[model samples]
Target chain A: MAEDCILETSGLVKEFRGFVAVNDVNLKVRRGHIHALIGPNGAGKTTCFNLLTKFLEPTRGQIRFNGIDITREAPQKIARRGIVRSFQISAVFPHLTVLENVRIALQRKLGTSFHFWKSDRGLNQLNDRAMELLTAVDLAGYADMVTVEMPYGRKRALEIATTLALDPELMLLDEPTQGMGHEDVHRVMELIKQVSANRTILMVEHNMKVVAGISDTLTVLARGSVLAEGPYAEVAANPLVIEAYMGTEASGLASIPANDDRPPGPLPGEGDDHGSLRSNSGGAG
Target chain B: MSRRVTIAYLLGLALLLAAPMFIYPILVMKVLCFALFACAFNLLLGYTGLLSFGHAVFLGGAAYVTGHALKVWELPTLVGLLAGTVAAAALGWVIGSLAIRRQGIYFAMVTLALAQMVYFLFLQAPFTGGEDGLQGVPRGTLFGLDLSVDINLYYLVLAIFAGSFWLIQRTIHSPFGQILKAIRENEPRAISLGYDVAKYKLLAFVLSAGLAGLAGATKTVVFKFATLTDAHWHTSGEVVLMTLLGGMGTVFGPVVGATVIVTLQNELADKVGSLVTVIMGAIFVICVLAFRRGIVGESLALYRRMIGQKAG
Candidate 1:
């Protein structure tokens, strides 16, 4: 592992009932860089992201974050270690106001989470900072609005703003721009760019435009393994990467490519591996 | 605060103060106890998204402990209540630690199973008096004031209920309450935000259990008995009905639910006799089918819709 790498994984594997969803994968993300993991639908990108975030335990391999071996750490522990994540579904407290959502994130730093008897007024101290974070995300105008009422693009923005309130060293975002329109995609890309200035980012995104536009480093996964890794321009042009993208439509559903069993494709497997991968990929990635 | 909520609370306070004059003090006390019990249960079900089907154990179990201490050990009234509250909290910690290992219906099942175990233990245990329960427990004086009189006990019950209600309100609005709501709204999201979801859940459970015990202890004092009725699974079901009927997530929902249900039981049990259960079942079905959000939730939604239309 390089000294500058903020996150490193070696031989990471996730298996369910003898079916390996993510095979032996070695992923290293440099500090202070936006690293995008891009792959075909069944490439195990989401699985890889879950493993890194400690949401799913790896069957084998070690994950190191900031020089700490975090393979056995819990998801919340990993989050507290400065690696916060945003869900693909725009994880905001639907009943809470946008400011309350951000304030909940900021409250962890205050170390009064267990102080149940204290008046919530003590949390008033954090309002200015929470507001600042919302303002940074262009959500200050909607501070008092309950998050469920916010527009989809704005919800994603709120998710990012909440994640940013943690002041994390690394942020893991799964499909930050999934299900977005042309304009939403553009706004999120710019927001990611802005937030990436101070912290490292590891994201699994399906949008090729987003991958190409802002990713400083790209790792291509197919069949739960890293098919290629390099800068966006280099990896995007690779024949193996081209082969992976060709069989699959740019619309993101081009079968599993499981039969090819070669470069940029899933290895030949027993029948019915494709059954849940679609749902898993959609939900996880 | 919304104008509606403030007015409702004021109305509630007035009703509470004037209730003993019109209604039987003991009946009002019973309602207050159940109301507190429902509110405590709501902290988990409404705000934390946990459904515990065995909460009656906490309330009933505390009643037994307080009755035992006050009657046998001859402890002071306040001391006996504290003992009951502590006992309930400890039980809650144990049960919550185990129950929180599961989620949704599974969590409810775990709590229900544990409560059944508690029921059997009390049934077979010597101190509980088995089928007869701890009977004719004394209602001691508070400080220097004698609490044996109906009026005095009413005030005491009112004060305790108000304090518990205010505490619940404080908790819901407090930072810890915010986290509970967040966990209820979305667990994985709260976890990713660096919250130990299990810990928050366990704490909420303990708090709920402790408060439930307070209600039970108070009930024991008013009724002068801790019986099988307190610990029965039927009691657990009744509290769930109260919360759902009032409004699962609303601030005043549980109290309203308790009032409506207790009134229904008090009035109908006399005329309809055993058919009260059938009527309650019908009410539950109607609440679930028509106003799924319960009375308070539906009213709030309606008010919001009206206000939003006017503003727009």
Candidate 2:
């Protein structure tokens, strides 16, 4: 109920049949802070994000955004309320030009979302702004190119650019740097930091360095419940947080010591450790 | 790019102006009516990615309405056409709301089932004259100009066809059309961007249905009768064939497809009547196997390739 909290969830619960995917939990994200949600595999991180975005209905609990109840709002309705989200998979309109992908998002703010009678040529006015967002993400030169032709990492950047076009007050990023190269991870991490200025971001990330490097607040969920919540350093040193992650694969966790700068290598399905690293399924926690 | 489209438009206009002097006006009018029908159907199928297998309900249902208005109610030609168009639009809104609940093939099947219901309704409806249909529909004067003559009727049909076709082209290039394409390509992404996808789909359905109704109403005036054949399920399949054969996404594709299919039907009616469906089936197969993009799509790709080669 704090005035500074932009997004607050109380007793959020989601159950799939009989199994509870996201158990009762409360989360509050302060305005203008980079908050990261991290947990091991099957930790109900995605389910929680889906519940917040209204993509999946919660079995119980309420979510308040900007002091308004948004728990019953439609996904698009919540998006209109300035809480926009990006998918874990690069979610770009593959057939549309990169410029068009961004322009469609911008069109919503201009009140032209349902203007079927007007020529799309009138939308040329938004091109300059779309280009600016694309340029910020280093995609200016590829504006006219179809999104499918863009490289993997660049597609993720395009997704960020499209999300940024919404000018969201509370951006929910689902694994911003999920599948990327080392250089791409660094570039996207920097891009996220640049965009995070003057905006509140709640991201579900697995990359330790990206989270530790940028996140002002961290919330770790294990087995459908919050295990630790605090500043990155405090949560990173939390004994329970370390055990929850280490109990999974340990390879990605073992590399990150108590006070080390070198973050763990790419998580599952990223690069070299793709097939070798499996998402830990059976979590008793 | 606009210049090229304008040139094509002007060329098409010139060809149409010269057509009635040589070919039969009635046949050409038939082609134009079917062409518009196919184009309207493409708006939903190609642009919105929602296929309605029962689209003939709009076309045939409008024909019956217009025919009844002209023969029974004795309304003016324009007024009857307007009534038919409104009726079809209302039907589209209702059917689209129900059909949009399901997706892909399920949507198509729901539409098909709805069309069958409409078909039986018309089959027994008193105003539609049952199997005999509404016969001897009067083609009244248009703004003081008489349309009883074949040449006069031809020009009026031509005007309506061109005007409706232009409206459809404008709709496709509109901001609303862009949203339809966005939803077609990636629906969840469109939703994430705060679009009410259901509303857009329903609007498109209504627009397409209104235009298809316009085509049907005009066809009644041209033919002087509204028959069971117009509302038959076979008519739905034929429009799909025309749109697919000419290219679903291209603007001129439906016209080309309708012309080809209608011409084939006319030519084969007397010589090889029974084989017409078989030959049409063969063409469909060939188009699907070899030119899946349809005629216009293939040509456009070739043109783009040639331009790319020259630039490279």
Quote the true-contact fraction of every model: 0.81, 0.79
TM-score of predicted structure 2? 0.93
User: How do the residues A95-164 of candidate 1 rate in per-residue lDDT, one tens digit apiece?
Assistant: 9999899999999888888787777888889999999998888899999998999999999999999999
- Evaluate all candidate structures by whole-model CA lDDT and list the values in order: 0.87, 0.87
State which docking tier applies to candidate 2: medium
Q: What is the TM-score of each candidate against the true structure?
A: 0.93, 0.93
Looking at model 1, give its docking quality level.
medium
lDDT of 2 by residue, B42-116 (tens): 999988898989999999999999988988899999999998999999999988899988999999999999989
TM-score of chain A of each: 0.86, 0.89
Which segments of candidate 1 are over 4 A away from where they belong?
Answer: A1-3, A247-285, B1-7
Worst 10 residues of 2 chain A by lDDT: A276-285
Q: Model 1 — TM-score against the truth?
A: 0.93
